[model samples]
Target chain A: MVFVVVLLTTMLLCICIGSVNIPLKNTLTAMWNTLWGLELPAGVSKNIILNVRLPRVINVALVGAALSLCGAAMQGLLRNPLADGSTLGVSSGASLGAVISLAFGVSIPGLEYAGTMIMAMLFAFLSLLLILSLAYVLDRSMSTNSIILIGVIFSMFTSSAMNLIITFADDHARSIAFWTMGSLSGTNYTQSAILLGTLLICGGIILRYARELNAFAVGEDNARHIGVNVKLVKLVILITVSVMIGVCVSISGTISFVGLVMPHMTRMIVGPNHKRLLASSMFSGAIFLLLADLVARTLLSPIELSIGVVTSLVGAVAFIIIFYRTRKAR
Target chain B: MLKAENVTVRYGDHTIVDHLSFHLQEGQWLMLAGPNGAGKSTLIHAVSQGAPYTGSITLADKDIRRYKPAHLAQKIGVLAQKNNVGYSYTVEEVVGLGRYAHSRGFLAGKDDDGEARVENALALTGLTELRKSNVLTLSGGELQRTFLAQVFAQDPEILILDEPANHLDLVYQKHIFSLIHEWLKIPGRAVLSVVHDLSLAKKYGTHAVLMNNGKCVSQGNINDVLTPQNLQAVYDMDVYSWMREMLGQWE
Candidate 1:
């Protein structure tokens, strides 16, 4: 009940508090009219709320929630406090796909637009598969530190590849710039609907494994002994989290720190029960990103600063404060 | 009743624990004592089904291979030697995980007395005070006690502890073994522990299986199997007289 209240209240405030000076009353009526087929107003307010600001805010929340939830589940699976979704090179691989798509007119030969996005997501997903499988074959123990180092190496490789694309490609202008920086400006409602549905379905599948996740917290051997098909559960979570983060990064273009900070915050509050921790992290992450978007729009006025920069700065501060406080308490 | 016939644990080309056999009667506490590299942990891991072994293990006349992991967990509770907390879990939460095999999805409110059992486990292990403490902040002795609390909370028919007393001081060690002794008071319950201390094995265990070179050298009543001769032969140590003195003190 508290979570729902906080979410709705935050959404209302986020919609009302952008640079254009709209009251909460107006924002509510406009949103109700737009959503429930009521009446409307004939100004920039409706379009800003519907087309520009609203989508941007929601996209931030969605990415935040998805990334953080995936991160929490990943940490649980890997049994490491510091693990995150992209530490397995999933984000770098996705970044490479997105960069390549914009730098060159590469669309998997036959696909275009949305198909290209899917192709980028697929590339990122497949790269994670390859790296993890290699790690598996090299050492069945699957050391977390080595896995992270593998991710860093893969990121370095892809980063160099990205620079190579930038240097050699014909379109080195604004399009590549926007693709690299990331924005919610281009996507329509159809894309939003498709993504929202995908998030719900995939997110629900993970939530069902809540108890199994707790079993995993004890240890893999212990979890398996308690009737969880250890390999099967791990494979499901790994593939699902990789695909989800891949899709999100493909669209948003490498949003960082949401996964790391959100889970850590939730851990500080709720301990480490994955069921509660996943839910709480999503709630806190959504609010966090929405607030960041609010500051991005209002503080810089007409020339909007990128949400990523704002999020990284503010989130780093909040995390450092929380970490310091937690350490002091201990 | 539990029986193992021709149990052999091999890792790649190296056979860690050689072909071994033992039959444990109900209410018999079996202590496996050996040197550090004598594959005591390997043998216990194999029995707990935590590793693969080329042998047959039967429990209560049913082939252990036939039982799945969840069923096996209910039948046997294993407290591994290590208290390595991979995540920051509270003591209560850690102990609660032991009852996971007993908890079903959306369980009915029928098990009202269950809370008492879990509480009793905490009190027995002397972790009732640190129920909310983060496991990462706990000392090694406290963490081992927490693990024991979990094993008690699980309430399995057979308890399998692998080097459970290593980090504990003598007081905690005696406390833990006393609880294990008390736990096996029921007619059907038993304990199989991997122990390095011969004095503990003799004082608390009903049977002792002295292992060396990955095989059992002597197996029988604890006092008889833990003799100075067998102790020197297996562990190659001069602790036989020292252990006897410690046993007298414990008595």
Candidate 2:
């Protein structure tokens, strides 16, 4: 309840504070008009509200929630504080996938309806598969240190591939270059809905497995001793988390820290139960991202900053605070 | 009965547990007594199927290799000398994992059965009060008890403990043995634990297997196999003198 109230209210404020400066009441009126299929009053700027602000704001919030939730789940699933959407190379994989698609001008015909996000999703999943394979290969010695190493190595590999692709692409492809930095300018209601849909589905899948994840934190042997199929649980979590990160990375580029910080904060508060922690982190991350994105767009007014920059700044500060608090308690 | 016949284990090119054969009747408290490098831990791990080994281990007269992993988990549980929780998991979560070997999939949001088993295990190990505590915050003895709770939750027919008394106070140590003893009394259940403390094995063990240099030097009734002469032969120490010191401390 606290999370819901905070998130809904922050989203309302973020919607009103962006550069075009739509008044809260007028924005609501425009939204209501759009919802009810009613005609806008003559002279009101419907195009600004309809085409630009609403989709962007909603995407920011949804993408933020998705990424943070993925991060929280990854940390718990991998049992490492540093595990996040980007840690697993999902972001770099998505970027490589997108840049390659753009550089080759290779549009999968007809399914163009599915958008570049689909290709990004495929790349992210493939990268996740590689990471999971590394983890499985090291099954007997599934230490947190080993998983962290795998995540870092894979991220580096995918990022180098992404950099290689970027080097060969034309300046026209630079629009996509901002994606590697994580921008939210180009999303429409179509893309936002896809992100929101993926978020809802992945969130449900993760939440459903929350109990298994809780069991997993104890260690693989204990998990299996209790009757959990350790191999199966690890595989499912790896694949599901990959898809979760893929959705976030595809819609918005490599947004960082939300996943790492939000989940850690929630775990610090609620413990590692996964039942409430996943939901709590999702709410906190969404609100956090929406608020950060608002500052990114409106902080300099006419000149926009990357959404990733805002979150990383806030995320870094929050991570230090949480780290200190966790250390003190320990 | 649980039986190990010509069981051999090798790590890399080196043999750790030499061919060993034994049959433990139901409710038998079997103790493996040996020096530190004699592969007592390796033998336990091998019988528990945690390490690859040669020869055959049969439980309830069924070939061990034929059993499914989950089926074997329910039939046999092993407690290592130390357990490390990879994160700040709650005691309940740690204990709850013992149900995984008996459970099918993601626990259905804390089922009544799993919780009941966790509570029962915690209660048995005197850790029911610490269910919500963070495992990392626990003392070494308390952590050992928590892992004991996990093993208890597994409710295996045959239990294996590798230096189970490490870090535990004598009172809790005795309590741990008593809990296992009481559980074994239920019929068809047995325990095989390695012990450096000969007195513990002498007091609680029904059967004893003495090992040296990765081989069993003697095996049989506790009173027979734990004779001071046999212990001296296997451990190459003055067993009578050490036994007297243990008795002195206990008294």
Best by DockQ: 2
Candidate 2 C-alpha lDDT tens digits along A127-210: 877776787687554554666678788878877877777777766357667766788886788888778788888788888777
Q: Best lDDT goes to which candidate?
A: 2
Candidate 2, residue A78: how far the Cα is off, in Å: 2.3
Any residue pairs clashing in model 2, and if so which? A225-B101, A226-B98, A226-B99, A226-B100, A226-B101, A227-B99, A227-B100, A227-B101, A227-B102, A228-B100
TM-score of chain B of 2: 0.93
- After superposition, the stretches of candidate 2 with alpha carbons farther than 4 Å from their true spots are A42-44, A108-118, A134-146, A170-176, B63-71, B97-117, B245-251
What's the TM-score of each model vs. the native?
Answer: 0.89, 0.90
Per-residue error for B36 in candidate 2, Å, reads 1.8
Q: What is candidate 2's lDDT per residue for B36-66, written digit by digit as tens?
A: 8898888887776667888999988899868
Tens digits of per-residue lDDT, candidate 1, A1-330, equal 676688778877887776677777777778888788877866537876777667766777787788888888877877765677877788778878877777666665543466447756877887788877877786565544556777778878888988888888755546665566555554556656656765797788778778778777767766755456566677788778888888787777676777878888888778788879888888887887777767766786887766677777877898789878877987
- Give the lowest summed-lDDT range of ten residues in model 1 chain B: B104-113
